[model samples]
Target: MTDTLLNEICALETALQQSQVRNDRIRLDGLLHESFEEIGRSGRHYCKATVLQDLSHALKAWHSAASRRMRRESAAAHSPQD
Candidate 1:
C-alpha cells in the first residue's frame, strides 16, 4: 500500500479505537461507514484490481466488527451482565 493509503487507514483505525474507548456507538458507526466509503472511492481512483480487492476485504472486516460490537452491547444491556 502507498504511504498515503496506509496513513489514512492508520488514522481511521485510531479514530475507531477512540470511539470504542468512549463507547460512542453513533460516532463509531458513522466513522466505520465513512471509512468504508472512502476506501471504496480510493480503490476506484487507484484503478488497481488488488487495491480494490483489499479495500473490499477491509470494508467487510470493519462492517463485521461494527456489527459484532453492536450485538455485544445489545446483549450486555439486556443481560444480567450489565
Candidate 2:
C-alpha cells in the first residue's frame, strides 16, 4: 500500500477513536461511508445512523452518571461525619 493510503487509514482509525471518546456524531458520520453497516453480536444490524443515535444517548447517560458519582464523592469527603 502507498504511504498516503496507509496514513489515511491510520488517520481514520484515530478519528474513529476520538469520535467515540467525545461522542462526536458529526465526525463519525463523516468518517463512515454512506452504506456502512455492522452486524452486531446479537445478530442485530446497525447502520451508521443507528450507531450514532445509540451512542448519543449512551454517552449522555454515561457522563451524567459519572458526574453524579463524582458529586457524591466530593460531598462525602467534605462531610463532617468522618
Candidate 3:
C-alpha cells in the first residue's frame, strides 16, 4: 500500500479504538460497513446492533473497574512505608 493508504488505515484503526473506549456508537457505525459480522469463539454470530449494545456495557464495566483500580493505587501511593 502507498504511504497515504497505509496512513489512512492506521488512522482508521486508532479511530476504531477510540470509538470503543468512548463508546461512540456513531463513530463505530461509521467505521464499519453494513457487511460487518463478528464470529464468536463458540461459533455464535453477532451483527452490528448486537456488537454495539455489547460494547456499551463492556465500556461501562471497564470504566468502573479502572476507577476502582485508580482509587486503590491512589491509596497505596499516599500510604506510609516502613
* Whole-model alpha-carbon lDDT for candidate 3: 0.83
TM-score of 2: 0.68
Give the TM-score of each candidate.
0.41, 0.68, 0.57
Per-residue error at 23 for model 2, in Å? 3.9
What TM-score does candidate 3 get on C-alpha atoms? 0.57
Q: Which 10 residues in a row give candidate 3 its minimum summed lDDT?
A: 16-25
CA lDDT, every prediction?
0.62, 0.83, 0.83
Worst 10 residues of 1 by lDDT: 42-51
Instruction: Report the lDDT tens digits of candidate 2 across residue range 1-82.
Output: 9999999999887877774543777777787788989897899998888888897898889899999999999999999983
Q: Could you give me the TM-score of model 1 versus the true structure? A: 0.41
Please say which candidate is ahead in TM-score: 2 or 3: 2
lDDT of 1 by residue, 2-82 (tens): 999999989878876562532544454455543344345445542234434555676688889999999999988899752
Model 1 clash pairs are: none
**RMSD in Å for model 2:** 3.0
Model 2 Cα shift for residue 38 (angstroms): 1.6
